[model samples]
Target: MLRSVPSKSQILRYVKGLLITWKLRWRGVDCEGRVVVAGPAPRIWSKGSVKIGNRVLFRTTSRRTSIAVRGDARFEIGEKCFINDGVEIDVWKSVEIGPYCFIGNNTRIADTNYHEIDQGAGPRVDSISIGRNVWLASNVTVLPGVSIGDHSVVAACSVVTKSFPDRSLIAGIPARKIRDIEAADDYIRPG
Candidate 1:
C-alpha cells in the first residue's frame, strides 16, 4: 500500500523535527535511551513505519537521507543502533535491525528489489534482519531474504543476495565470506 499523502500537520511537524534533530545532535542527543523518528522526516514517510529502541541513532546528516517505504512496510530498530546518513530502507514486509548494529552511509536495505519479474502486479514484501552488533559498510545493497549474523561486517558496495552466518566478514559483488571475523584492530566492538 502506498503511503497516504502527507497532511499539512505532518509537514509542519517534520520541519520542526528536522530542526530539533539538528539541535539535539549539536547538544549531543541522548545515546542511552530509546528514540523514534516517526512520520518520515528526513525523507518521505508515507506508507513508512519505523520503530526505534533506546540509544538508537537514526540519521547523522540530512543529505540523501531518503527512505521510501511502500504501504504495509515496517522498519524496526533495536537499542544502541546507528543508521548513518544517506541510507535508504525501502521496506515491504519488515526490516529489523538488532541492538548495537551500525549501518554505514549510503547503504540500501530492502525486502524486495521490485515487483515479481514476470508480473508487475505489486512488489512482494520480505524481511531484512541484522543481528546484534553487525557492522555494514557503505554502499552495501542488502536484497530480499538476506540476513547478517551478529558481529559480522559487510565490506562496502557489496550486494548481499543470501544470508551469512554469525561472526563472518563478507564482501564482494554477491557478498561471500572472505573470512570469519577474528580479533581485529581496525574494527572491534565490545562483546
Candidate 2:
C-alpha cells in the first residue's frame, strides 16, 4: 500500500496544534497523552484541573471549542475521544468523560447553572460523569449532575437532564431513552 503524504495545510494545522498544546500546558492544562487538533485550535481556560488523555482529537473545523475549569473543579477527557467544533465544557465542580467518546458539534457540557436563583446563595454546582464509548450528537446539551452510562448514544439537539443506563439510545428535547443499543461495540467509524 502506498502511503500518501500530508498536504501543506495538514502540516500547518499539526504545527499549530503543537504550539497550542504547549501553550495550554504552560497555562496549567494537564494533557496525559498525544492530542491531535485536526481542525482549528480550541480555547482552553483552566484555573483548576483539566486533564486530557491520549489520542484525543479536537476537530473544530467549523468553529472554536472551549473548555473552562473554575475554582477546584476538574475536567477530564479520556483516551481516543473526539470533540467536534463549537463544543464547550464548563466545569464548576467536576466533569469526567470516559474513553472512546464522541462529542458532536456545538455540544455543551456543564457542571453548574453558572448563577444563583436565590440572591443570597451560590450557583447550583454538581458533577457530571459520562461513561466510555458514548456518542453525543450535535447540539446536545448535558446539564449538571447527569450520569450517562457506557455505550450510550444521545441524538441531535437533545437536552440530557438526568441519568441513563448503559447502551441507551436517548433523544428529544428533554432526552429520554428511545431504545437500547445491543451492538454498541460493533459500531466503529472507519478512518
Candidate 3:
C-alpha cells in the first residue's frame, strides 16, 4: 500500500489555520468544536461572547472573513456551518446561526448600522437569527433584526431587510420571497 503525504502548500495552510485558531482561543471565544480555517485566517474581534459549535469551517483566502462584536453583543454559530471567503459579521446586539448553514462568499450579516441614524439618534441594533439548513448565496446582505427561516435559500446578491418564513426562496434587492422551496439537500457538506 502506498501512503500519501501532504504537499508543502497544504502544510503551510494547516499551520496558518492553527495559528488562527489559537488566536481565537486567546480572545476568549467559547468554541466547543473544531473550527478549521481552510483559507487565510479570519479576524475576530470579540468584546462580549462568541460561541461556535462543532465542525465550523471558515474559508478566507483573497478576501478575509471578519467577525466583530462590541458592547454586550453575542455571536453564535451552530454545528457544521461553512462560511466562505470575505464573509463579514458585525454583531452589536446578537446574531445566531443554526446548524448545517452555508454562507457563501462576501456575505455580510450585521445587527447594527455601525453608527447612529439621522446623525443624532443611536444606531438601530437588533438580533439576527438564521435557522437551520439555510443557504445564503454569494454577495448576500442580511441587515439588522432579520430572521431567515429553516431550509431556506437566499439567492446571490440579495439584500435581506425583512424576515421570511421557512422553506422559501428569496431574491432581489429588498429580498422578497419569490417562491417556496420544494426540497433540497445540496447544502449539506459531506464528511
Candidate 4:
C-alpha cells in the first residue's frame, strides 16, 4: 500500500490540514472520534460546508488518486464512515453519504459525467446519496442521481447508473439484481 510518497507540497498540505481541522472545530464539525485522512490532504477537500460526524476516514491511494472539487459543492458524512483507498468522490453538486457506509477501493462516485454526452454543451448534474451500511465492492462506478439504499451490497466492477431498493444485492457490468440476497444462504464477499 505504497503511495507516490508525500512531496514538499504534501508537507505544506499537512500543515494546512492541521489548520483546517482546527477551523472545523470552531465551525461545529464534530470529530470527537477520529477522521483518518490518508495521503497528501491536497488530494482531498474539506470545504463547501462539510459536516462530518465522529469516526470518518478519507483516503486517496489508488490507481487514480484525484479528487475534483467545483463550485461550493457540499459533502456530508455521517458517523463511522469508512472510505477505502482510491475512492474518488467528485462533488460538482452535492454528495451526501450516510453513516456506517463502507466504500470499496477504486470506486469512483461522481455527480456529473464530466463531459457533455451530446457534445453540444449543456449543464447536467444529479447528486448522489449513499445510505447507511451500504457495502460497495472494488472497481464500482456509481454514477450521478443514484441513491443506494441501506444494507445494499454492490458487487465489484459494477456500474451503478440508477437507484436500487433497500437490502438488494445487485451485480453485473451495468448492475442488476441477480436474486434476492435473503434467498441465498451462501453469500460471498468479493476478493
Off by over 4 Å in 3: 1-19, 115-121, 184-191
Question: In model 2, which runs have C-alpha deviations exceeding 4 angstroms?
Answer: 1-13, 117-122, 184-191
Model 2 agreement with the true structure over 5-26: per-residue lDDT tens digits: 9999988877876786787688
Could you give the C-alpha RMSD of every candidate to the true structure, in order shown?
11.2, 2.4, 3.0, 7.9
lDDT of 2 at 79: 84
Residue pairs with colliding backbones in model 3 are 40-60
Write model 1 residue lDDT over 31-137, tens digit each, in one string. 23434353333553536565556755566445445656567677767787777788888877888888888888899888886866666556655688898789999
Q: Order of candidates by TM-score, top first? A: 2, 3, 4, 1
Positional deviation of 30 in candidate 3, in angstroms?
1.0
Clashing pairs in 1: 1-71, 3-47, 33-54, 33-55, 34-53, 34-54
Each model's lDDT: 0.73, 0.88, 0.88, 0.72
What shift in Å separates residue 145 of candidate 3 from its native position after superposition?
A: 0.9
lDDT of 3 by residue, 1-191 (tens): 99799999878876775666667778898777567787667888889899988778898867989999888889999988999999999998999999989999999999987778697788888899999889999999999999999889999999999999889999999999999986564545343
Reference-based lDDT, residue 154, model 4? 95
Worst 10 residues of 4 by lDDT: 182-191
Error of 1 at 51 (Å): 1.0
